[model samples]
Target chain A: MAVYTDITESELGAFLRDYNIGELLSYKGIAEGTENSNFILHTTGGTFILTLYEKRVDRDDLPFFLGLMDHLAQRDVSCPLPVKRADGEIIGELAGRPAAIITFLEGMWPRRPTTAHCREVGVALAKLHLAGQDFPLQRRNDLSLPGWQRLWDGCRERCDEVEHGLEAEVSDDFAALEAGWPADLPSGVIHADLFPDNVFFLGERLSGLIDFYFACNDFYAYDVATCLNAWCFERDHSFNITKGAALLAGYQSLRPLDAAEVEALPLLCRGSALRFMLTRLYDWLHGPDGAMVQKRDPLEYVRKMRFHRQIISATEYGLQQS
Target chain B: MAVYTDITESELGAFLRDYNIGELLSYKGIAEGTENSNFILHTTGGTFILTLYEKRVDRDDLPFFLGLMDHLAQRDVSCPLPVKRADGEIIGELAGRPAAIITFLEGMWPRRPTTAHCREVGVALAKLHLAGQDFPLQRRNDLSLPGWQRLWDGCRERCDEVEHGLEAEVSDDFAALEAGWPADLPSGVIHADLFPDNVFFLGERLSGLIDFYFACNDFYAYDVATCLNAWCFERDHSFNITKGAALLAGYQSLRPLDAAEVEALPLLCRGSALRFMLTRLYDWLHGPDGAMVQKRDPLEYVRKMRFHRQIISATEYGLQQS
Candidate 1:
């Protein structure tokens, strides 16, 4: 649940004057994104999402996030395009927070994703990577190895509160991930946080991708690795190889992976798992003690990373050998 | 922040099958109402609000809530009429909670209301009261005097945590409220909680009323009293007489206040003020320590109640003596 900032009618009316979109009919604070205050804006023109970027998101990266969406939507990729203001600015300010209005996309994210949904996500993600090739803005993956280490250090003393031996086990996992991190593998603009919640579908067909707040320049295969962790896991923490095969097969249908990219898949998967685990653990220990936001169980990611640790080859994740 | 219940795609799809509303296009969990999970459901037909009643709301009282909206809408009052299922049932079970789909009302609630907005609210609220006159179903205002004392008892020991001498002050206020509480003065179906957030407006016109979860049989003047505390106060705690005058005058345009009701206005305002102050104080002291929902500041209402205590007559609140 979100909407930390409240936008007033007069302020919103003043803000809308800079846009070509018709009169503001209504807008609602949405319980969607965590790092931003999101409102579903309705106007005589049509519906759009008005996002007021919160403090957690860096203001400097606004152009990259908005520009990437605009770039992707222009191509065959299905994504929201940032509505440009009268002065041709994609970003604006509202209630002391940087904001942007993005064209609304019609779809609901698959909550209990089937194999078909996984395949559709693979196809959409690949299309996004292809479309983002010429996006003209750059943002490094902030949740990469170095960032993970910083997060781990911040909560290292209290990390064991989650699991009895979580601290020591994660320390070893950190060392391995750092040593075997992918140096190079088909790098492009990757939706670094391409979780199922960010991918929306109209039934079984992919409609759009959203929450580009975490989109950045990284290994495209690393994006695939994130999805492998997010989409392939069953409720019992068991990996579903059939879904994995469907995802990879769908990805290959659009953009084929090279030899080295496939080989680095398992390590990238470990890195992705570790990345989410460390952040969740840090939040579990240090997040605000209140009833306004629900905390995700860090131990769930601990179970996931543990599962990824046992895998030796990309073939275990249903990727075909070249 | 709201939307506590998570509805799976298959579950929602199955639920929507019972309605002729058309294919589900998109739905986003809204962080609006506190007691229920509200999802903005967009289908091929149009936009609607899907509310899954949380435990805080009584399931048995749902017919009254749903039926009141249906009845009020038929009488030309703007509200979210409950969309019935194929079997003409307004209520259904979804995600283990009692849920219903209501037609979406367009407009935004005024954050910083002006005198014009207050006048518009007065006009619409009277209309709702008039339309609800024949509403057959009856539900008591459980949060009235008795409920206030029960809440006060739960937090009496820790009442001083909010302010020194608070316990004694509130005890006296309670005694006075009980004695002065209106015995009978033109009571009808009242939107027991018609705070600015529950009322919507497009431009200056009051588009509709929402969050009827608190609607019940109570003094119509008491409902006005709730608004007096909710709408007429400035941020610094001083009452705005201009806004109050507009609200009173606009409301009297349709439903003239009886002499008895007018005489009882001050005590009813105090009662309204105390009712909110008690619940908010209880939440402030005993609300969940971890993340899930927000607890409003109780001291603000305490200040408003104090203001009402000093007032001699309704004339002080911009109401002309009848």
Candidate 2:
């Protein structure tokens, strides 16, 4: 209930004293987030975001998250660069949580992002995946297919209580997904949560990307699946063919997906949709009582899962013939 | 963190003692939900679901939720029936939370729900609207056109942090929706969340409906919008015209839509999709961070919203000329 991490002006000043960055002039908590507690710090030299790892974030993964920023920044990717300490460590302990300070990149996350936005995002995402090809550290997508089933298994008995036979149907769908899991596609580090909010833009151009929490080594096409599910639709929750076309073209223009990747897109999109649906469904079924978190209607994703379920045929997603 | 409410064997026995209808043989906590704590109770008479209101549920609204069930049941609509307690009250206190017991209908929520299922759901939904014509409660959809802008305003500042210019576009859409808001359409209570998980089926027939938390008085065609968003889509999140046809035909068979309703279908669908996208977008901006509640990719709905945005003409939704 108490403030999990409270860094006063003096405390933050002392915290940054050991860092190579110039004198810290001002710092305050950014109240607009639900995940990590972020403080926008304005120093004599520059501006940066100081994030204190929250409950949802694994402390052990702080290095990976911070190191990823450093790595991506070094690769000329327009992303936040982790400000290292004098000891050369990118992460630090503050307010009893793993913390890091990173130079804030310019540009805003697109609000009314247009089809052109989707296209640029697709291109940028492909480039990010390529840039991550040689990144040192590796983490598996723990919330992938198998992980989803395990979570569902935990909530199976309760499923019937919420809606009669919801458990059985979910089980069947999971089984089907498992049985048809794609094999031997191009694999690499992917920004698995490439939602529009995570991607920043200046004018019509994509400026940078953020939120690497779900970034992991996975099938390259799955990232495209994530994008198609994210960017191709408008505010009304309907599919836009023009946007879909532009996005796919942009992605292909950058990375040029092979025949297998193109073939796997529809299924991958379905899997991506199901992945979120199952997770959201699980959360809907078992979120802790009286928590500050607002629970989303799992039925929304249920509709999405159903939409994806119908995409069994390759032509359903309008994938260009390889 | 410890179990918030523990309904032990003796406690549940005492709780069920006053109910007049059936013999309580067995009761168990149903763990598959994120909203309310549910128990599947098998009595000498029949099976029922005992739902304990959780945090997200407003205790005051228990009457609306429970009464709607009773109202629907009285109208010969297939839905759960709320059981009255010995005190002549439908609502009761359990585990320091508002609670109620309702008859559990037979059938599954449909995992791989087919196009046939979509048609059946459309028909059932139409029947539900017709049956709900004279229901006493006068609740309006809290998430209607204006409600969306209100939510958008609350989260607009942080909107830049997620999707760029979503705030402005949503505002513009709201203006457009308001300028052409439909009036003089047939009015009725609509099951606003008609997703596959909320509809139950026995073999090929729809046996019952659940989750009327979003039911409200609105233009009848809005229900169709909800359905088109829920059904008539393949798993890959693309619209399926064949499925759409079946669903429309089925609904028309139950209660034929008026010309105005048909004319408004595309915008209504767009409105419905935007409603969900905004809700999901708000959640993405300000939802709780936990291992359980996975943030839905807002971009999925974003893509859906965009599709709806492109539908400037009624012909886009395939409405036949009256």
What is the DockQ for all candidates, taken in turn? 0.77, 0.01
C-alpha DockQ for predicted model 1: 0.77
The reply for model 1, stretches above 4 Å from the true place, is A288-291, B288-290
Residue A99 displacement (Å), model 1: 0.7
Q: Which candidate tops DockQ?
A: 1
Docking class of 2: incorrect
Error of 2 at A176 (Å): 51
Off by over 4 Å in 2: A1-322, B1-6, B21-25, B31-33, B288-291, B312-315, B318-322
lDDT of 1 by residue, B79-195 (tens): 988998999998998999999999999988999998999998888888888988889999998998888878988999999999999999999998898887878888889998899
Q: Per-residue lDDT of A1-322 in model 2, one digit per residue for the tens?
A: 1123556444566688879788765443433234666665656676677888888788777767677777888887888888879999888888677888888665555556688888898788778877887888888887788887787777778877666877777777787778878977999788888876677665577878887877788898888888887777665667777777777878777788887777677778878877776666777788733253346665555556667777755455555554
Worst 10 residues of 1 chain B by lDDT: B287-296
TM-score of each: 0.97, 0.49
Instruction: Report how far off residue B322 is in candidate 2 (Å).
Output: 5.8
